[model samples]
Target: MDMINGYLEALPEEERTPDPLYRERLDVCETCSRLQNGLCAVCGCFVLYRAGKTSSECPCGLW
Candidate 1:
């Protein structure tokens, strides 16, 4: 249990607000299987941008 506590403490702070645009796009993708309004286009996953690993240009299409 002590190890579990240490692991939890080591994790980054939890985000209070889910990315609105990403959530919306996720919903759209689940239902539409495509980027909503072409926002998440070329993004295989919605969290790619938030994770800072996507190599494409700005994907802030929704906003």
Candidate 2:
């Protein structure tokens, strides 16, 4: 459910990051203590979708 919501909330395609960058961001999110399940414990955002958006960023300053 969170994954679907994340994708739905992602920035428009024109503003999204490349696949590689998105994955890199996901990797960073996966290792963070703030990530809970598929969401960010800090902001309660879906890491997958959030990471895919070039306009978005880690609230923790990891990215």
Give each prediction's root-mean-square deviation over alpha carbons.
Answer: 9.1, 2.7
In order, candidate lDDTs are 0.41, 0.80
Q: For each candidate, what TM-score against the reference?
A: 0.26, 0.78
lDDT of 2 by residue, 1-63 (tens): 665646746657777878888788988988888988889988788887777778888998998
Candidate 2 C-alpha error for residue 28, in Å: 0.5
Candidate 2 residue-wise lDDT at 34 = 90
Off by over 4 Å in 2: 1-11
Clashes of each: 0, 0
Where is model 1 more than 4 Å wrong at Cα?
Answer: 1-18, 33-63
Question: What range of 10 consecutive residues in model 2 has the weakest lDDT sum?
Answer: 2-11
For candidate 1, list the clashing residue pairs, or say none. Answer: none
lDDT of 1 by residue, 1-63 (tens): 354335434545452224464455445444543455433545654433332222223344532
Clashing pairs in 2: none
